[model samples]
Target: MKKIMFTGGGSAGHVTANLALIPYFRQENWSIHYIGSVSGIERKLIEELPDVRYWPISTGKLRRYLDWNNVKDPFKVVGGLLQAYRIIRKEKPNVVFSKGGFVSVPVVIGAWLNRVPVLIHESDMTPGLANRIALPFASGICTTFPETTKSTTPGKSRYIGPVIRDELLQGKAERGRELCGFRRDKPVLLIMGGSLGARRINEAIRKQLSPLTSRFQIVHLCGKGGVETKLESNNYRQFEYVNDELPHLLASADMVISRAGSNSIFEFLALRKPMLLIPLTKGQSRGDQILNAESFRKLGYAEVLPEEQLTPDSLLERTMDLYGNRERYKETMKAFDPGNGIKQIRDWITTIMK
Candidate 1:
């Protein structure tokens, strides 16, 4: 059996995507092991998978600033490199796949130095700093957006679209609506801020709850670590997080309002749900969210709302416009092919092993 190692962590989306590809690997009878940081959300999720062994490594942020903490980052990176070297030497995998986050950086470097074949998947229009830094050493780079091609180093890139799990592909939308207690004839609204949840988005939703709940049933995913629903109503259903139920909720929604995180945006695209995007604006994350949202909007797939001007009233108006013109959005989704990306990645792994 070929030994395959996978590295990526930080968020549920990336971790779940890694887990989703497990069946494909198993069917081919490959021996698979996962490596991630003990600090990330992967620790909680990866422990549940059967027959998959996991190892932990210390990782550090590649801060984009020149500050006191930035001085400490290199030390963290060095320590992580040492840890990753030990992992690669012990496991001796034929290939390593990365989902592109800060934690994956040291593993990428270690794998490359050890002559391990590395494949990277960057799920955004603008690749993350970790992936960009790892690009020069990657044997192959897979992207979810066509626009991402420009951001990568030339000669080692492919466009395979988004890799959505089977659940989202075959899930019943109407069943999700019913589960949320939504009317069969009326449309449903789905709001997600990602695994950690978005406080600002939740706040806006709270303000608009009265009006939104009146016409549409709402499925809101509050960030697991953030605020809970303060308002209670029959038309609104809330979850701290949805690991298994995401597909049902995505399938059931007529429209979605969310932050333009790369993973969440692609999930909407896979479901072909019309969306209004509110990109993140605060903190150290910078303008990457806005860039991704704008790129998708330019493709006519979704509408962009920079957080500066994203008020509850404006959001409501934009959502109403999409609701009134649902046919156009449906047509947009029909033009997209959501399958085969993950399969392509799986095939590439098999080819490399041979």
Candidate 2:
């Protein structure tokens, strides 16, 4: 039987694409193995699949800032490299697929050392530190944004657009409304602050909840530990995080307020949901979210609100603006073609294996 090794982790964004692709390989009778950090979210997500064997390895955070962990992280990465190399050697996989997170770097290098072809999927407009390091070793790079191709090695990069989970497209709006106990009298507004939650966005949204909820039924994904138990309202509901119910919530949403993560924004684009994008500032990241948000803005699918300018009043104004002009955004999004990313990437893997 053919075997494939997969690696990526740290955030849900890194592993979600892999999740979208896993079912296909399983149906084709391929042996699937996953390598990820022992304690990362990827382990939990991947382990839930019965057929895929999950391997835990040492992994270090790849930070752009100076820190004492910088001194110790190299050792962990080296250990991960050695572990990954041994695993690849023993498994003798036909290929390795990476989703581009810090944990993926060692696995890509290990695949190269093992003489196995590796394919990488980069979700950001620009390659992150891990993908940048793995690019040289990868046989091919798949990008979500057409603009990303300019930053990658020529001929190696292909723009496949976004890989969306099939389940997300099958959500029922009525089910979502029932779950939130919301009536159809008002349009539903969904606010997401990314996986870890955005404190400022949370504060701003809560501060204006009374006014906002008056106009729109609200579903707030508050991220981990971000939910406020003291707050209560008939038209407003909050979740710390969602797994299976996300699609339903998304289906019921008439508009979205979210952080500009590429995977997420692309999903919104695919769903034709108008958005208000609040990207993470450069201080919080490498400014990739800023680029992602701007790309959407230029395409007329969303409105951008820089974090520095974010306030309760500003949030309310921008959200109202998004709702007012939502039809235009939806029309623009309808013109977008996300392509068949899952099929294209699967074809690439099949070709490389042959």
Cα error of candidate 1 at position 325, Å: 1.8
Error of 2 at 52 (Å): 1.4
Off by over 4 Å in 2: none
Q: How close is candidate 2 to the true structure, as a TM-score?
A: 0.98
Best by TM-score: 2
Give the alpha carbon lDDT tens digit for every residue of 1-354 in model 2.
999999999999999999999999999999999999999989988998879999999999899999999999999999999999999999999999999899999999999998899999999999999999999999999999888999999999999999999989999999999999999878999999987889999999999998998899999999899988788677889998887899999999999999999999999988999999999999999999999999989889899999999999999999999999999999888898888999999999999972
lDDT of each: 0.81, 0.94
Per-residue lDDT tens digits for candidate 1, residues 1-354, read: 788888888877667568778777878788888888877888777777776888888877777767787878788878888888888988889999988778888998888888898998888777888888998878988888887887788878888887877777777887788677777877788888878888878888888888888788888888775545556567888887876677777888889988887777877887778898988874537578888888888878898877788788987788788777767877887887776888899887767642
TM-score for each predicted model, relative to the true structure: 0.93, 0.98
Name every residue pair that clashes in candidate 1. Answer: 196-223, 197-223
List ranges where model 1 is wrong by over 4 Å.
Answer: 66-68, 227-230, 282-286
The model with the greatest lDDT is 2
